[model samples]
Target: MTLGRTSTVPLADLVRRPELGLVVLAGADRLDRPIRWAHVSELRDPVPYLLGGELLLTAGVNFPEDVDGYVRGLVAAGVQALGFGVTPVYDEVPASLVDACVRQGLPLVALPATTPFLAVSQAVGVALAAAEHAELRWLSEAQAALTRAALRPNPLPTLVTALADLSDWWCALLDDAVVAKAGIEEIDPVVVHMARRLRAVSGRRSGSTEVGSWHVVGYPVAAARVLVVGAARPFSVADRAVIAVALALLALADRSDGRSVTKMLLGDDPHEGYRVVRGQRKARGDAEIDLGTGLVDADGDRMRAIVTTVPDVVAAQTAGWLLAVSSPVGVGDLPSADREAARMLERAVAAGRPVTVDDGVSGLVDPEAAARFAATVLAPLATRPELVETLRIWLACNGNWDRTAAELGVHRNSVRHRIGVVARELGVDLADTQRRMELWFALRWSD
Candidate 1:
């Protein structure tokens, strides 16, 4: 209910009420059309001051003959309803005016002979004010309802119900599967948009959006995500605000552990998680590990990183030395928290004791750790300049002598010989996929 930025009274409700005094009333079908209200003054060209929806009042000062041109002019001006004021100059509601209105089906209202035009104007003004008040009240109630729903013990249920109520349509919460939560009997395409946004936002760290006519607010929920979505068929401002509040509440309710990488790297027990390297064993660990510094190719550049995790002797031996990477803390200027974390891991390994690389972020000690260990162990073999390229090509081809030979333009026998030299130097069986994998990483680490 809005009128000229003032309060809005529904035209339907305003018309039905009797105290407003309707000497003649326009039917809703005509009034409901696209209408913008304006007060006009020019008797010669009423259409000029009219922006349509005008209850044009006149004392028949310049009543046109035949009425055809005058009525057509009003229609062309996009007038939704007409109000004629009767005075001594025009003592009666003219038969011509009524005939024209009936012919066109353009609603016609007669301002009473006793009633001044001022009274009609005042009534419309009052209706506008009422409409505005109703709009404000609707917004307030909607916000309160959404707020209450957000705090409920089972928030999703409350949210779905709220959305249905707001939109006056059925709603559903869908993950991989659709859960019919509340509102109408079946799912609508509009609600489907809401579900998709909710799922998409679950994986991202931040951000929100408005989709179609509806305002969809998504938040991370425990083991799931949630969205409160709705608006009247096309959605409105009030509905958007309500959904936004619901999303905020859901976010607050369910928080997550930011230490996913740490938990995974630590293995079982944090106390004795890291493996120790001694002489030959240290050489083997080094062969499998890669510190990632300066290993670049035509395709992509490699960034150096250190992964330090809680010590687990068995897990480290099995998984190789852990190195932390892929953190939110980007590799920037040295002496940052991330740089410090890398330093901690390096120091722990250098000290030959299980140590924790805690820089207030998570750690990763997995296949990446094994890659680092392999590189360290194979450093001596890689130093032989002649053998370096040969071993690299062979491993890259997965020890396939023929493919390695073709890539390197060497004979199969020569390729086999170079591979043997690498295997013997690294003290591993090149024929074993597992052993080949270890040597492969060692070569990468050395690079």
Candidate 2:
């Protein structure tokens, strides 16, 4: 069973045990309250000697003069429930005590003549210990999960999501700004303010608080940054320990050197699929794409990068900067991926939109042999840019004279003349369907 952090045993756990034979006499509705511990007390006023949430057991040997005031004091001390031993106190629960308990909404349990007070205490102690052990096991699993999450390509989001799942609550990160989160859309403003305040301090600071319905913890993991995690209930000892492990992991994550991380991501685990991205810096922006220089290599007006998968956009697009992504490849073949991305970039520039390489006739044959075939067929028009472009546009238009002419921004007669010249120069028949298809494949590879 999936168990969360628990420090106390619920009163209902003991009441439902058939062996205990404990009967709820008054305030039965309050049995769900948490019991910190079970204590046997007979003094008239035990409030000063007691802590909250204890099952205060009594035989009423030294009964108080004022029963109503006594019950009120117990309630004020936050007693989980009052247990009265029947024979030792009276034949049954005293009417005065029961009436006072019912009036003040204090749960009163009748300990039968058979069950000793020590047995009830022992049951509670065992339950509390079992809960503690289960929580420790849960915490150990949580720490391992966080470590695995830190190994992901996008660790911040992955780690945040893991923490949320572990605590059954929401988590967010603040890096001079609220950067990432999971399991929630909005956090309490008070919690956020506290986190931001924690960020301004130094010396590995951390804090927690009760805000409205939430219990929030702020971990100042990095300089000017904080990781804020919260749940509806108070955090237990084990829960706080798990949070501490997360903070240390995040600190290491912040200390990650970009260059080394990029290197680690690239060559290691190469057999698994990886993609290369090519971006042509056509426009300038305040933000430049920086997945790190090792991952992204800049050459002239273009840059190439390797990633685990494609993203919607590479950081900031910088406006009109074209991007083309290559098909997946491994480490040994990674160098060739740059060339593939370059070809895709040319295609993107031609189509005026982003382009990604996909399986076509190119996949049917060895790429080197296909390139040789394209080079041989289009060798005649290698020096002739006009014929190559005209053929490309004409074929794209499905041999429509007017459409190709409009797209090429040239007259139909000029387009026709250029096609005839291309046919003659390449020594191919334009009317043959097979010939056109072969030439189309060749031209695509040439581009």
Candidate 3:
């Protein structure tokens, strides 16, 4: 089977090769890092002259009196293991070095006197090149798979599946890492670490996981990163590039880069297209224009177009035309131009319009979604039925004890007591903005 480019043959796999005449003091299964090749040398203090993972070969020209120090130096310098070739100068593996290696947990191979060091080094180098070549072949296959998928009328699903197969792992596409996707139920620690690092480095969401024997790949879609995790022993390089290309294409398609017109009109970056304007009330700060829009003063025009003359834009399956407006307005302003656009789009779809947008879009969405999300903060108190609803009401009233008490038909002191109870149950800091935002998002379900 073709392997992806990101794949590496495990070090253990190399050890399993029967033709190498290689001796194993260390097992072949170690994959903590990659071995570039094997090295053969005659120096006693090879540490100074050597790089790590050399599969070191030495004839012990100046064998150490204090072998512990020598072994420590090798390990410290990143040597994977030691192979001592017995020669006339040192006819047997030194007892001191062997003891030191065993004590330090470094792998030590006893090289046969009849076997030349060159043979061992040559064998390892050949294996490494072959492994790398195999990875390239795997990557070529992945590219072919993508080409086939792209030829399909609807390529999203096919492309995603092809990615999964190439990585040899289960995968999930995310609009935001926070938002979960189908077939990806949990985020493993390794995947999370890689995702965060890649996002920080690339300013794009990406992640990979090595669960048990398999390697997983994750990258962004919309605002989220797609997670592909499998049980293969190692990941190939080609697989990594394939993932990068696949995600890039997804972003190009304007699907997972979080560049929704809603996001843009709300003043988020669209990467390559569209512009967004946040209201003074919302105050997200800064404006964005899509490079593809082909306009100067793009944000300004985009705003004007939406409010003064344009029709609503509809999402594929959802009802209503999508419209965005700026400035302050009360939550009661539902069904305004923006809301109407959503409604109109829904109606148009009901008729025959593929999509529509309206310029008069303005209005606050019902806060109920956010409120319900916030109520999740009280979920832990589910066991305390007497206090659950009361806690929700207190928090809902903006932590106003008097108002909460009035609503709960109880005294202010009782409201305060119940809030304390709720706070204790939720295990959240009432004062931290981040924590509060989580609760708020849950209440509004917007986050």
Q: Superposing all C-alpha atoms, what RMSD in Å does each candidate have to the true structure?
A: 20.9, 15.2, 21.4
What 10-residue stretch in candidate 3 is worst by lDDT?
273-282
- Summarize candidate 3's per-residue lDDT along 179-210 as a digit string, tens digits: 32334457666766666665555454545556
Error of 1 at 280 (Å): 71
* 17-124 per-residue lDDT for model 2 (tens digits): 999999998988877788879999999999999989899999888989899999999999889899999885588888998899999999999999999999999999
TM-score of 1: 0.42
Best by TM-score: 2
lDDT of 1 by residue, 152-191 (tens): 4355566667756754544555565554367545545555
lDDT of the candidates, in the order given: 0.53, 0.79, 0.54
lDDT score for residue 337 of model 3:
38
Query: For each candidate, what TM-score against the reference?
Result: 0.42, 0.59, 0.46
Higher-scoring candidate on lDDT, 2 or 3:
2
Instruction: Tell how far residue 279 is off in model 2, in angstroms.
Output: 29
